[model samples]
Target: MQPHQIVSREEWIAARKTHLDREKEFTKARDRLSEERRALPWVKVGKAYLFDGPAGKATLADLFWGRSQLVVQHFMFAPDWTEGCKSCSFWADGFERMVPHLAARDTTLVAVSRAPLAKLDAFRARMGWTFDWYSSAANDFNHDYAVSFTPDEIKSGGKIYNFGTSGFGVEEAPGISVFYRDEEGNVFHTYSCFARGLDMMNAAYHYLDLTPLGRHEQGLPYPMDWLRLRDQYQPAPGKGACGGS
Candidate 1:
């Protein structure tokens, strides 16, 4: 950890109060942005997306499970991969706990991936995650959402992700999409955010933001290169010893 300035109680309080004012302003700005996000126009979903699950095929509307709103985590697990992406798993770990809370607010949270339903189920069970997860292997949901890129698209250097703002060549990417179901059972695509826009949805990252090291990763190959699947992490050390890769 970098050394921080030592300060007297009076000096510390004065500094903290100054920072607090900025935090309040930031909080208000975030509130206004959220309101604007909610007010954005929606697009009617024309495709009848069918997702494969343990129970069988389920449409996008069926995924809502009677809720008026649905939140889909576009997880990055391709059909051939034996395991899900470590970073996507990190986000999923936090999302599983939020299922009940979101349901209480009439919102359904689920994860969708391009991997086969069996593969998804196996990986999910290995991670001990129970939040609803489905496979889009039988449909074009992933491509339609711009989270999965075709081999040709990658070969030609496609820039379809993030609304064509980026040229990520990976076979899959991570995103969050929101949909609203009206009384007539029409599902509308409300909003979708990709890349760092997902940072706010992760509780652990926010907690880390308050720490001195702040996710570390200074010289790492990538921001999440140090991450391991939950079961793959080394056991925590005793007392103050650092551990768990």
Candidate 2:
């Protein structure tokens, strides 16, 4: 490939406009897809699902928490696992501020994991997050949603299948499930999406795309590595490190 060169201000502006026009089409397409998804038929979830809450046991209907709608994010934290997945944790971090707005819209947003309540709480404390999280340790909810694997499936080494006839297998796939409650107290599943569908909530990627590096990693989920609770984030040591100090 030819060596990259910095362009002049006029050239940069023109290029930016061209990029923005393309991006506009993408945005419009996404909006249209979202509308179409919303129009899909609702699937009634009559089966009772269990969840461990802060106070005690809760059912799938209880997830609404008195709201008409509920959004559950399948966070990657198996019951036997020690900690949450790094990428899932990053997505969970954004829910702190979004909870209020979702509540205002008569929707409750919560993170659901396969980990036990105690372990989930511990990790949440370490992360300093206040978003509501619950355990689905005793149920097949995660497996049903293609977020977790069954013991037998794991033993067979064919657990990472997607939702299809050929057996949908995936490794701790991230997902968002939406539910709505009717006047008669029946809950219905409205929408569910996984993987890239959840990308908008990733603030890191959105910010990185504006930088020169621009998420350079080809196969990595996000550009930044997993951050620990106690880790102090310092900019990469470089020429600009002392410029603003």
Q: Find the candidate with the highest lDDT and give its number.
A: 1
Error of 2 at 94 (Å): 2.0
Model 1 lDDT tens row, 1-245: 78899989999999999999999999999999999999999999999878897678899999999999999999999998989999899999998888999999999999999999888989999999999899999899999988999888888876778998888878999999999999999999999999999999999999999988998988999889889998886555553324434
Please provide TM-scores, in order, for all candidate models, with all chains considered together.
0.95, 0.84
Model 2 TM-score, all chains together? 0.84
lDDT of 1: 0.92
**What count of clashes does model 1 give?**
0
Evaluate all candidate structures by whole-model CA lDDT and list the values in order: 0.92, 0.80
Backbone steric clashes in candidate 2, count? 7
Which pairs of residues collide in candidate 1? none
